[model samples]
Target: MVLQGALGVSLTFNCGDTDVAQEAVERSFAIASERGDPLDRLRLLGPMQMLYFRTGRFGTALHYARELAAVAEELGDADAATLARTFKGVSFHLRGDLRSAREELEGALSGRPPKEVASYLGFEHFLAAIFLARTFWLMGDTDLALEQTADVVSSSEESGHPLSHVITLMWAVTVFLWQGDIEAAENHIDRLETRAAAHGLQAYLAVADGFRGEVAVRRGDAAGGAQRIRAALKELHAARYELLTTPLNVTLAEALCAIGHHAEALEEVRAAINLVETNGDLVYMPDLLRTRGRIEAAMGPRKRDTAEATIHEAVTLSRRQ
Candidate 1:
């Protein structure tokens, strides 16, 4: 019964029914706890953490990750413990604490678990590698970041985990986008779209579309890009996938600014900035701040001081990270 409930949680999450998955995970956790089965409890924590992470509830996800780490330690499960620590690092990444995130993720990657242990843990190592790549990129190590991300993408494809492969590709697209490599980003986005469509992964499909929209905007197709992004945002919001909202909104703001819609762009940027401040999601803060500055600058000389201050803040924060 517990196994069935846990499986249901994964199924519902893949189908983008996050609310149902959360309920199923809670039931599975309760059953596992009642049976005094530590393994089952740990098994249930994976989906619970994923559910919260996708919904942008970083604190709750971090809580589950810490609990998973403690339980894995009690069970003497090194691989599981490593996986839990990686997730904790990812939660820190989402919260914009790159220093702490890098520490934890690097600590986990410093050791290699056996093949069987990694398989038993369900490709968590790959997820950690992807996050680590992003962290490196954000820390201004583009070459190293690309190398690490490429390795993960290759390994994921060879591991026969299609879902993990697709996700890794999505992260790769993000890295390329950040590097201003539009052609490379497009290639990865195309691959991700194909794989996500094949697997019926709605959230990934939306993500792929969002990337495409950003690329289009970068290429000077503001109206077309904004339309695509708006459609993707609607789908993402319906699925309650708030994790990507910050980046997506920042992209939209850039598109609006391109088309001389400073007022709308300012509103969008400000809203995203507010959400980041409220949620402590510092990962995307620098980008949001930069966007806010751009919007303010477009508003004319009267706002120049505000623009300078905002941009300076972004630079300072980015350097600190």
Candidate 2:
């Protein structure tokens, strides 16, 4: 029954339907409660925590994190303990506690043997790698971020984890965009879109579209980019993933600005900023700030200094140790 529940939850998450995934998680919890198995309960907590984390429910994620940590201690499984730590670390990261987030992730990494991390489960090492990469990215250590992304791609390919590969590709595009390597970014976006379509992974496909839109903006293809971004937003809305909707809007704003639509772009950026602020997603806040600044700069003297200041602040924040 636990196995069936895990499979169901995995399928639901893959399909981009958080509602079905949460229902499966609830079922898993019910089963674990009935069995009174520490290990099973710990296992159930992993997916539930992830669902909460992805949905911007950080408080609930922390609650499940504590529960999972207790269960891991009781069960004494290093892998379980590492997973719980990773989930907890993500909650902290999203909450803007960079120091605490890195501490938790390092602790989780210390608990797992290097060779065994990726082999344990689908998300076991994948999430760890992404978190580490994101941490480095936030710290403006693009070299470290690139190295981590390379390893993630290699490991995911070796393990045949399609979703992990898709995520790795997404981050890789972000990295390239940060480096101003438009060609590399475009290549990665194409690869991600192709793989996602082949695998029928709508969630990752939406992500690919969003990034593709980013690439389009970088190339001054604003109309094309906006079209792609709007499509991505529609898909995200269809999936009821409100948390992910912010990034798409941010991308849309970028495209709008590139097309000399400063006023409309400012509106989009403000909307994204509002969403990220309300949802407490500091992890994505930097991008919102940068977009707003760029749009404001494009709008001319009335907002140039203010926009530049916002961009500088975001840059400083992203470079924080």
Candidate 3:
């Protein structure tokens, strides 16, 4: 019963029904707690952390990470402990503590918990690898980041799990995009779209659409790309999936700026900044600020001071990280 409830939460979350997902998680946790089974509680903790993380509630996610660790230790579950560490690493990354994030993620990945552990933890190691790759990129190890990303994507594809394939492919798309490999990005997006569709994973589909739109813009279809991105953003907002909002908004702003739509670009940038500020999503703050600076500069001399200030803030944050 508790396991079914946990699965229910995961399914609803993938379908973008956040409220139902949270309710299901709460019910599952309640059941697990009542049963007084440490393993059951540990299992429920993973989804609870994920639910909060997906909603940009990093602190709450971290709280669950702590609980997960405690329960995993009580049960002597090394696999669960590894998964809990991964969650903590990701939460740390989101909170802008890059060094600690690197340490935790490295520890999790180094141990290479068995495949059964990955299955039991719902393949969270894939997510950990993705976050680790991102951290590597942010820390100026782009080559290693790309290598790690490729490894994760390849492994995920070989795993033959639609959920894992879609999630890993989505991050792989981001890596390709950052590398300026538009063709590679599009290819991964295609795979992600197919897998997400097969699984009825609406949230991943929306994310793919957003990435596809970004690729289109980069490929020189600025107007068309901007329209597609706008549509995807609408879908994401409707679904209350704010996980990718900052990056998508940045992409949209870049597309608009490319098309000489500085005013609209500025608006998008501001919206992204507001989102991160309100959600406490510092993971993308530096990028958001950088985009804001670019838009402000494109708005002309009237906003030059604002542009400098915005860019300076980004630089300061980057250095601190």
Candidate 4:
């Protein structure tokens, strides 16, 4: 029962159902607390920490991760320990402590727990690879990012893991967009959208649209890209995953700026910054900061120096891993 509830929470969380995820987490925690099973506790801890992290509750997530690590040790479960360390690493990343994040993630990967079972081992590999890919992408090692993504893709296919494939597809899109490979990004988006629709994974569909919007904006198709982004944001909002609204807003801001709506673009960027600050999730704030800087640069010379400095900070922080 406890395991079921934990898995349910994770599923709902991934699908952008925050309220359902919260309820599931609460039930899982209650069950684990009553059962006094260390692994169960760790299981519940993982999604709970992820929820907190996604909502910009980094300090709370960090606290829970530490507690989870201690419990994993008591339970003598190396796998759970590694998972807890991954959360800690993510928390560090959110806090802009990239060096610590890299160190901890490296340690977790180095201490790779042997694959003991076939049923869920594929997920383990995919999760670890995705986490590493994200960290390396942030660190500006695009080659390593692609390599890690390739690992996830291969393992996901070999294991027939649909969810893992979806996640990897998103990661690949982000990397391609960052590398300025519009054609590759579009190809990946098309593939992801087709798969997502066939599987009824609306959240994945929304993410795909968001990525398409990003690529469109980069290609100077302001109207087309903004339309896609607006649709994506509407879907995510309906699903109650406001946690990532910043990215959508930034995408909109870019489109707006391209279309000569400078004042509106500035407003959108400000909203994104406000959302990031409120959520305390600095992991992607650099992107928002950079966007705002660009918007400001177009306004006048008075903002040019400030804009350049902001972009410099973004590049520096993003490469810190």
State each model's CA lDDT, in order. Answer: 0.84, 0.75, 0.83, 0.73
Q: How well does candidate 1 match the true structure in TM-score terms?
A: 0.95
Cα lDDT tens digits for candidate 2, 293-312: 88888888989799989999
Ranking by TM-score: 1, 3, 2, 4
* Candidate 3 structure, TM-score to reference: 0.93
TM-scores, each model vs. reference:
0.95, 0.87, 0.93, 0.86
Which of candidates 1 and 4 reaches a greater lDDT?
1
Which is the winner by lDDT between candidate 1 and candidate 2?
1
How many residue pairs collide in each prediction? 0, 0, 0, 0
User: What is the alpha-carbon RMSD of candidate 2 to the true structure?
Assistant: 2.8
Tens digits of per-residue lDDT, candidate 3, 1-321, equal 466576656665576467877877888888888888887777778778777766767677888888888887888888878988888898888878899999999988885444746455456878889989989988989999999998999988888777777778987888888889888898889899888888888988888889988988888998898899899989887877767777888889988998998998888888777767777668788988998898889889999999999999999999998
Error of 3 at 278 (Å): 2.3
Q: What is the C-alpha RMSD of each candidate to the true structure, in Å?
A: 1.6, 2.8, 1.9, 2.9
lDDT of 1 at 221: 95
For model 2, state the Cα shift of residue 101 in Å. Answer: 2.6
Which candidate tops TM-score? 1
lDDT of 1 at 28: 80
Pairs clashing in candidate 4? Answer: none
> Candidate 3, which segments miss by more than 4 Å at Cα?
13-16, 116-118
